[model samples]
Target: MSLSLLTPLGHSNVAELIARRTLTAVFQPIVNFDGGTILGYEGLIRGPAGSALEAPGALFAQAAREGLSVALEHAAARTCVAAFASLGCEGKLFLNFSAEALVALGETRDRTVAWLNEHGLGVDRVVLELTEQCQIADVARFVTAVGALRESGIQFALDDYGTANASMNLWVRLQPDVVKIDRFFIDDIANDPLKFEAVRAMQHFAGASGARLVAEGIENAADLIVVRDMGIALGQGFFIGRPDARASREFAQGAREALDAGHIAVFPGATRTPVAASPSGGMAAAKMIVAAPAVPKSATNNDVLELFNRLPNLHAVAVVEHERPLALINRRSFMDRYALPYHRELFGKRPCMLFANASPVIIEKSMTVEQMAKLLASDDQRYLADGFVITDEERYVGLGTGESLVRAVTEVRIEAARYANPLTFLPGNIPISSHIARLVEHRAEFYACYVDLNHFKPFNDRYGYWQGDEVLKFAAAVLADVCDPTRDFLGHVGGDDFLVLFQSDDWLERAMRALRAVDTGALRFYADEDRAAGGIHGEDRRGNPAFFSFVTMAIGCVRVSPDTRGGLPYGSEEIASVAALAKHRAKQEASGFFVIDLDEGAAQLHLHEAPGAAMPQRASALS
Candidate 1:
């Protein structure tokens, strides 16, 4: 069992050493950002004593060329599983498996399961890390095999996400439990704005997909801090712990200590963490209730003019009956609809009198400015109201003017822009959560659509960064235009992604058409050379030839209905959950658009059958 004999003598010797159980396993601990707890360790395999296969990378490479990669992989898996069992580590164990080797795993499935069960490890605790570098020729079979193992508690992960062209597609198709972001992106996230924005967007996408993001190749405290701030749940790098079998126990203890000490920074990249203002510390509470000012339905144009003169801050006058808001009269409406000479005569019969057609923005007493901003941004100009009448149920509580909403929304947008994906200028999780809460309080019917650009990165890679920016801006404009002021809302959730809302189901179809129209027109910006080639040029990691395909979008829609059972309205969190589920379903379908109705009390998923329905249409010649 000398190491020299096992040293790459030939494929036979390597296999013999593996069969003899001479291979050793090393464990590298993956740690949490803030807690610094050992989340898991990636089990790295080493060669037998004195072997030329001393370098793990070279060892695996040589095995692949020699056609013994599968056997070697199995041996490594068994060794790692055994070592994990002996160490009594509760965290997950990540074991690398080449796609080429996974195909053959079917033959050894039973054996592998038995061995894992024989040890303390179960399928759930062991994560199979599939490298994207290898081509997966048969995805269906691969998925079936992995899915079966997953049912037995085994989970799969895509290693080196964003490093390969096929990785993004594989991630969507395979839907792994974890995605290990490549080191190239994480290495300088804190210092490089471009890389930071890209990774942040990736993190948002991962969260939406219900997958965990692990930052790999973290070598310094700075890198660890940056990754943590970016909201990466799991991290593996030399700073946390290097790979070693006997060191696992020590590493776990150290990780726990670090967490307790708060030695790790949560978000190194955040300029500032948000702090809520103390309610009692802000504006003084009114000692007495002031009667809300009112405007009579019979008020003349002269009366309207007098009211504006009396109250300079007068945003709108409410017409009420028995404490119910009947209509809202704005200063501009009266001035535009009535003449000074007819003021008295028009008093009782003016067309500008508060009517059902007059748009009104309603708000609850507890609403924050951030929530109101999202509502304002979702609509077109016609639906713009001066302010919302704050109410509790049917009774008026107070007033929320556009000035107040403007100030509130500005703060929120600034905060959002800090962490938002810069390239796309979309709000991240922080704002989305607030917007959902506000929507729920309103008891409004709104549709939440999870928008994803299909084959975007490939397009980005083919086109330069400038072209990629154009595509993202184009999508943003499309979303803004498609959203109807009377019934819809839209927000940029992050890169190549958007969250759109509509009060009417029919509006979803309309919005889709508009999105398709805009996307089609936007594609023309690509130079003729790139269009003729059907791809753009870029440099690969190794500075090799890189060509990427065109971009398209996939949408997942979910509708949130008003809850009438309780006197209070439904909340945004519920709607967001439903929307996320629908998006997942849409991604699963061949079509790009999928809709789900959560109001049905169960998941009812529907997919739009039109191919490229989300794609923009060709423009007609005019002028």
Candidate 2:
């Protein structure tokens, strides 16, 4: 409700309300995902009924204008505590307070403790949520007050984090025990990659700071499941339990069932192609749909012919029954059959099913164009000529042609390839980062291999870039050949740098095989004399003659195990840095292969020789 819609009630109304202490408190349950149980209740305040200030927005606005915000909060706190104690609600009671009000609460600490004792509530059960409504002008004073309050067994929570005033600086200064993520980032997080990443970053920060995270405004089961699987501590929204006069003791049946489900929700992966104009993955089948007329299954061939005649550009007409598509009749084929000798009179009046293809391809409007591309290779070529029926929940909506599907699929590929290395046609940095994120979300053990060419610049100067390009392609091909198609991903991080996320158990063997291939094949790119001499003379950076050897491969591997995560969330950027650091060490080794046991909290380095398993060479150089 808009505060502007309320009448201008002077300080008299606010003073009267505070004197009567008539504010009502409603409690919303916050669920802890670990046990699928309520962790606490956030007490929300309401104004008097049938009045202009009944809505909280209007009530707060009036209080702020009348300069009675602190007084009003004190009254609201008392009402909430009294109601919560009387209703016998379990867990902590979270009371919202602005910075100014919190300072006042600290000053009245003894009186507040006495009142809580009288109401059968303990000071330890109260968590004060610092709201963003008021600003903190005195950092030192506010911090001191917050510290004093916590000394009395009170907990502080940074509310609406990511919005005004609830920033990282404040969080650090206050060292809040809890941080409630703003609803803006929580809503639709299952489908929005940006929001998902934002929340993930916040989760990482919380982990490092020893602060628990509560995702707010999770209004659907998909979002709830996503928040739960992402390892967020607590969840709160209308779907969990709406704010009511009587606090809920348990979850509703649907929410309980969802929380108890065994499987994790499949979060929508980040689209390979980032299209600014379209946020719906830019490949929905609906985008390529052609609004065409449909004919009932009982309609005669004559009726189909009439539609074709009236709309000469029509390619095919869908045969539907009760709005469900059953078949499609091609325009050209029907016309040709009608043109045959006496065929028009014989079959034109018969059911359109006589000329219809009963096994027409049906696609849902929500299917991605990439999914529809598979039909092009299917054995049935009928879709090419007769087109396909588009539906929403099995009901006919429109039709799509093979031409449009092909075009959309081609566009998606072209856009996606925009991020690929032009020379090697391998995925570039964006996709590499995306894949790392996916692996982290899966919470499974995997190996990250960072591949780079040793001394490539000197080779490029002597052999020219044409040969350099060939060498890069050769490296790509070697990596691709050894990768398990279903378990591994290969990406080129520009120039001679590449990243391989290996899920295969024989990742060590595969890395060794690639190294051997490079050791043997890389020499071919050099001239016969250079190959014989095992080196080439090139100008050094100081204009001095230097001997540059042929380019060799360096492989750095990091074992990312969930068990060793230490309950600390790892972002893709941080993981990539670890892999890169390992690669830097690999470049220092004689064998050009270094393995880091990140899972053991020890960056142990291992070196492997061809045709043998990895053997420990030395301790990790990393600190």
Candidate 3:
């Protein structure tokens, strides 16, 4: 509600205005960005079309100047609720209450309840919004009053967040269900880095405190994306909706399409497919099962000899018994034995399985590329000649040539490791960026999280550079420990910043838990004095005595296309842009908290644990 200049119209006029009941309530829709659906309607009080009190600012200011603010607000609530119900609004009815009236809600709540019932509106449908514009005298009492009203099932929302009236202390005292970020920080958020950071920090604070965040006054598509990327739970402004006496019961098509962009089957005429631009780790295994030539156990030894000559490239042959691999016949071993005097005459007519090696190495078709490397490393001559048999559920599928396996492993490892950081051995910038492109191309849903330290630079300056290296190593280990091995991708985006692309659906909670643990454990790494002081003491670049807080990390998370959330992008570049914004927000907040940018993709969630958590990680492929 925008306030206007104090009216010269006096006390008598304020009283006269309330008696006339010349006010209108227009509702502004608060939308759920994830679904492009209306979460609720906030009732904004406005005066008559062209009167002196047409502006809410003028009406409230004149009333406050006359000590009749509470009386005026009570009247406004009655009028607003009645109009809201009559318009057939479908969501919660959010009514604004002045600080003056909040303290005196004894009769006001009952009167508002009566208006709601009369209009067929339930108390549960009402959300009493208190803005920070008014100086809340006695926060404890205010919190109590708001809490006391909850017994009737009415929820409370704190508005104009970040202002003095809605400070952290107030937030703790009240524990409001929702905090609407002030529009001051939302306007042109995409272009303004500072505002973007502020909004993201607020979003993280809200998530940690268990409050839903609402960004008010999103003006355009870019601003909407910025707010959505910060994972703001709800939004209000011209972009989503506008204030009108008649509130809309449903969202328009354009808004719906934008919100559902990421998961839909067809986007801009392109088919959405599972992200597979280039498979890595476990993902590569699915494509590695090449067909192999096999024959029944009854086939004569002559059949094997003839097969080798027919397909010269055949590395080895699997002797099959009832569709299961019974043994492997090495071309050289079989041919060498036959070359010895009369060997072919003695065995050429016998069953091939009888002469074949019975204990050849075998691997599952689903085994990861990394796992394959390990299995292949376990043997030499036996596997070298006979190669390895690929199976599906114990049934023979194909043969993996030793040379092919070695080449494949080397190529996969090289591709994955080339851009890895030397110190931590985590995939570096280039690979992370490429992975994002793969996500967009495949239309796979994954969480891309950017992680970094808060006070590392200062701590390093205070101590030595090597200490910083130890800290980086520790962080890398912790990340490896927490992230799912088979599904998640971890990369070192240079000093202090890392990226984790999560293939699981419940990554938000997992990310939160893991980072929280890191923050708790990181404290001991500091010097004795710094540990006691809660942070390192050092000189700033400008030579000032800077007290650096204990190391805390920030994780900025954004979900990639998998469920067609409107947060959908043309490619990795857009997601990177958003991640950069999220990273900035995380650094500013620096609480070792996870800030997830949520969209409709959250609805299609199916969290899967990553494969091979216990196995040692193969640090990036080749580099």
lDDT per model vs. reference: 0.62, 0.79, 0.69
1 against 2, candidate with superior TM-score = 2
Show the lowest summed lDDT stretch of 10 residues, model 2: 270-279
Off by over 4 Å in 3: 1-11, 107-112, 252-254, 263-623
The lDDT ranking, best first, is 2, 3, 1
Q: Mark the 10 consecutive residues where model 1 has the least summed lDDT.
A: 275-284
lDDT of 2 by residue, 1-623 (tens): 11121224345777688667678899999999888889999999889988998888999888878877777777778788889999998899999998988877776677777778888898889999999774897877787778888998989899999887789988888888999999998999877755776787899999999999999998888788778878897989988899988997976666777677544443434222233112333336888789998998889999998999999989999999999998999999989989999988898789999988998999999676546777877898888778899998899999989888777766765665555666666666766776777777767678888898987888888889998899998999999888864457787877788888887778899999999999788999988999999878898878888998888999988888776658565777666766776787898999999988664323332224234767443222211
lDDT tens string, model 1, 238-357? Answer: 667888876464443443443333222322222221211111111111111223586555554456667767887666666656666666777565555555586556563543353323
Task: Please give the TM-score that candidate 2 achieves against the real structure.
Answer: 0.47
How many clashes in candidate 3?
21
List clashing residue pairs in candidate 1: 3-49, 7-51, 7-52, 123-153, 124-153, 229-267, 454-552, 516-616, 520-616
Candidate structures ordered by TM-score, highest first? 2, 3, 1
TM-score of each: 0.42, 0.47, 0.45
lDDT of 3 by residue, 522-551 (tens): 887776877777776778779888778777
